[model samples]
Target: MDFNRKEMDLLAIKIRKNILRTIASKGTGHVGGSLSIADTLAVLYGCVMNVDPADPGKKDRDLLVISKGHSGPAMYAALAARGYFDEGILDTLNKNNTILPSHTDRLKTPGVDMTTGSLGQGASLAAGAAFADQLNGSSNYTYLILGDGELEEGQVWEAALFTAHRRLTNLITFVDANGKQLDGPTDQVCSLGSIEKKFEAFGFHVISVENGNDTRQIYDAVMEARAEKELPSVIVLHTVKGAGVRKYAEMENCHSTTVNREELEAFYQELDAQADDGGKGTGKEA
Candidate 1:
């Protein structure tokens, strides 16, 4: 797959649109965090990961585990963009018998590799998969994405230690440091001091992406992290809660909010206008 930055940008835009669609379908969902990770997910399912929508169960395929599984709408949007499933299914997000659940469930979704939503346990589960793959002599890499708020869980550090002790080089973790969580800002809730230093202390080669919302930077970060041989790698992405959209990003509680039908229609119009202006319809102004 020849990765073009412009195409990735378009995909990220589409994924963000899908996030809004999912939110509207359910009347409410994790809009902020979902939008925050759109660019990163676009890079992964679009170009970075070695995955096949056709052979989703292939043995050597790379795996993605969204640790902050509440952002499943973003992942679903990416998967749909990558041809994992029909894009039409995106509207069923969180609905009855909907495959697109609020959180990631591997068993229900076609391309989801891990069922997550228990906050901090996803990293450990991903590490365990990496360890088992190493034992089996498989070279597939397991990627895990977590929200900054999730760092408050003790299990994350425990998993980090385990990954380091075992030297799980095939495991790469990305922390979406969006700064805000469900309740409030991370600082007002529980300030995770020096996230990079803490991960480094846990034996991860920490790489910081100043702009986590940039597809090019996220792609580069993943490529750079893939080269680490001695220990696990973690990329901390400094991102806005509602990244692409200016209105949501500016909102204090965009973490999870309601978007009525009228607001949703306005958003699509906003996206189209941005696209016409040669920008990714992020609802942001210059």
Candidate 2:
């Protein structure tokens, strides 16, 4: 339950690196969005979220539901880093008959609480889990992450409204507002005007983090959300579509980029150089 911001930053870097390597192993995956939420995932699974890797099924433990499940590579790296499963499993991502798949599958992945891939269903599922926990008098929170573009789905709003109406304070959602989406920038694709105002209008206690890639900022936002008592809280994370790695971040459209052998080698080489440069930064890519 205790976290050092510096340590969390390093963990996020490691997770992001693993995500790149994993997706590279398969020659393709959701590289952009996966990188976008790396810091947030590290803050959750590494800094916060009370759950035992050894006792993943324990009733009183906190749960995480990834609504934008295409970003599973990030979550998978986080889970493996936290010892939910062997780290080697990450290299097998999306391989035929492998536990790791294109999208998150609870039945398949060791630490995945809910299977999600249809874009907007995970929010509703997390809401249902939160409501059930509340009814059962459990002191656990159900955390959900959704992409900014995913918010275009009407189902997410319905779940948000329900969470607010029921006063499901135990449910906290993080919108990964990384600007761009599959087609292009979310504005050009399907403009979601003022994500913060929209969540606030849905009766959520909203907090806006200027830099979602900052572990300290992410952790602070979660703590603030945890302190809210009246309604569900939503933290709007302003992030780069492809975070951590500079080349990917600079891409205009990196929803899912193909990584050939040379690209992957160059990517890891940059990370190696950063490490050689002391890897001293706390936030943002080195």
Candidate 3:
């Protein structure tokens, strides 16, 4: 499938804007991690995934499993932009009895294929889903997104081994290696030595993108991962935790914090400038 770089870039910026708006509605949220994966989510929902907003559970459509469930705002933005639901619902995020929760839930959201929040369980669930699809002779792909810190879980390794053993080439996983977690920098918390090598050792066809905030790079990586037919694939995305917003991107504790609505207009102005410049500022590029 071919992608229009300009369109992808615009979509990514819009997703980032929506993320901030959604989190701001709740006063505070997982903004850092959510912003980190905006570009990849744009690539997937824009042209890669075979999902229908009108028919979300179509049998042949590609499925996405977000292991790092805290990043639901990004996914929700993509979904709303893709017409899965009205964008107005984003204001209900994390509110009582709201469909758009802080974490992804398949039952609560139209585009969410798997409900996840316990860190490593989404990996196992994605693996099992892929294995099931393999058994049923389905041509659909199961895409999984994991936070870099999530790799610290022993269960992630177990899921990796299972996917490798099963040879589930239809499954493609992405690691949002934004360098920070809920606590602090991933290295300071628990160094993950060479994420690429670790996945490679787990028998995955690993691909790394230096600038994960770039939509073009992320799209290319997905295409490359799709070409691998022998083993499961993982794309390690080296992204900025709060990309597209200079203020948050540079913060040491942007993981979960109150988004000052008074500052959103200024932030949006910056995003507009970046978009006009083809997403150059804020380290985001098409």
Full-model lDDT for every candidate: 0.87, 0.86, 0.90
Clashes of each: 0, 0, 0
Cα displacement (angstroms), candidate 2, residue 231, comes to: 1.6
How much lDDT does candidate 1 score?
Answer: 0.87
Candidate 2 residue lDDT tens string, 87-171:
8888898898899998999999888899999989999999999999999999999999999999999999999989999999999
Candidate 1's residue-wise lDDT over 155-273, tens digit each?
99999999999999999999999899989999999999989999999888999998888877888888889888887899999988887777798898898888675687777666556
**Every model's TM-score:** 0.94, 0.94, 0.97
Among these predictions, the greatest TM-score belongs to: 3
lDDT of 2: 0.86
| Comparison by TM-score, 1 against 3, better one | 3
- Which residue pairs clash within candidate 1? none
Between the candidate structures 2 and 3, which one is better when assessed by TM-score? 3
